[model samples]
Target: MTAAPRPKLSVILAAYNCADFVERSIRSALDQQGLSIEIVAVNDCSSDGTLAVLQAIAREEPRLRVIDSRKNLGPSGARNLAFDHAAGEWGAVLDADDALQPGALGPLVQIAEEREADIVAGSIRFFSHRRQEISGAVFREDAPITALGLKDFVEAARPQNREPDYGLLKPLFRIGFLRERALRYRTDIRHGEDFHFIVDALGAGARYILAREILSYIYTTRESGLSRTRVDYSRMIAETEKLARQAPYSEDPMVAKALTRRADALRMHELNVLYGDATGLPSKLKVLARSLTSSAGQRWLKTKIAKRVVH
Candidate 1:
């Protein structure tokens, strides 16, 4: 008897109370063409029958395996567990409420193989029922595939208006590179953990590339999703402060300046979150004006206007 071959890609999906959408997410992953794929889905102690849904889907599909988490670990912890159980050369983290584009894995894997890149990210296609389509997150459709370095990533990471938020891009990683470095998402942070992970990986000298020629992921925007929740920018401030004091990020002048700007943005964002409901437009404008003083705010607003202009 011959053993089964390992899959080329392992998609680690961490689902938390997205019962209505998990099945579709799992199906999209299972339907990837031109490659053998495994869906490692972790049910993060969802009370909404998400576990049952995952189990039922798993029973019929040999490629899909569902891990029922005993406790409610956040997104980072759940994805960490899924990645540990994955049996693939390359791995990607997928959200339970979102999905992957058809035949997305082949090109990514090919690029990794040819370029020897440790991390590869592709632009996301925003999907909405009310709109034809949303804008790209990482790069425009016609943008050439570009090498993404630590400095580039940090600069683009600022809460900016015109630059692409690389944090929004879902990147595939070489399993060995991550495992060897003991790289995992930070469980302490409920927000901005993905950004933390990428920054750490890039700082560790991982060769990262942006493949924008082909859109790889489908981002399903839900009104009730966790993304709608206010970000814990205080957590971001504290965590980034720690990074700012440490090496690599602290050593480079450009990176240090960018981190300072980001920290200021986080501070401003934190204040806004605290004072969420203002009296009227005047108060809101006052708050907005205050935030715009920070470089991150200015950059974010600029790109936002640019997006409107292009579209």
Candidate 2:
């Protein structure tokens, strides 16, 4: 008998207590057109019916491979496990709560094949679960496909009024490149793992291409998600510090400067949190003084003062 041909793409999906949306996510991946893809889903010890749902689906779908984790391994660990089991040339990630639109994989694979890029990323369509509405695309739809380097990624990481981190825009990664470099997600970090992974890949000299026309990955916002429940300011700071110290930014003055500014913004946010909780005048004054020392702090102070004046 002839053996089955290898799939072109392997989608790593990590699910933890996402019973409500897991099935739809799997279906979306399976529904992707123009690509021979395999879905490698890891159930991260979900107490709900997530594991059962995946099992039932996998029994019928030969392309769907479900791995049940004996213990809860957060997002990073679960994805790492899926990656280990993946056998495709390219790797894509889809959160159990999110999905991939039809014809998503083909364009990405084409870009990677044509440019010989290590990573091919595109815009994401944001959908609000509560509102039942598709808000808009994250990156500009009209933007042309552009080659990106470490500097481009660092510049995108800079803190701004809008969500600055483009990590949520899931990209198709070359599996061979990642394996050769031994690149894997940091299992320690519960949040910001995607940001670190992308930065690390860029630092490792991975060729990146942004495909503006391929806006198929759907990022759905949930009120009960971990990001919405609590804000881990310290974790964000630690991730930023690691990114600042990465080899790609160390020798480059511009990238280093941008990282420093981003760090300052994170520090200012931490101080703001303290200021909001401080009850005594002396404590508030101390926070105010600290805020004045950093550029981001000064901006924050100006914004607050202007708001007060207007009110």
Give the clash count for each candidate: 7, 0
- The runs of at least 3 residues in candidate 2 whose Cα sits more than 4 Å from the true structure, single-residue gaps closed, are 158-164, 224-230, 246-248, 265-295
The window of 10 residues in a row where model 2 has the poorest summed lDDT is 222-231
**Top-scoring candidate (lDDT):** 2
> Against the hidden true structure, what lDDT does model 2 obtain?
0.81
Task: Give the lowest summed-lDDT range of ten residues in model 1.
Answer: 221-230
Pairs clashing within candidate 1: 160-299, 160-300, 161-299, 161-300, 161-303, 161-304, 162-303
| TM-scores for all predictions | 0.85, 0.88
Q: 1-311, model 2: which lDDT tens digit per residue?
A: 99889999999999888777788889989998888999999999989898998999999999999999989888899999999999999999988778788787898899889998999987788777777787666666777889888767766754452643565568889999999999999888876677778878888889999887777688777553623124566778766766677665767887777676667767776877888989999999988887787677788888878988999
lDDT for position 69 in model 1: 89
In model 1, which runs have C-alpha deviations exceeding 4 angstroms? 129-138, 222-230, 265-277, 281-311
Q: 205-263 in candidate 1: lDDT tens per residue?
A: 89998888878888876543533224677788778777877897888888887777667
lDDT of 1: 0.80
Q: After superposition, how far is residue 63 of candidate 1 from its true place, in Å?
A: 0.9
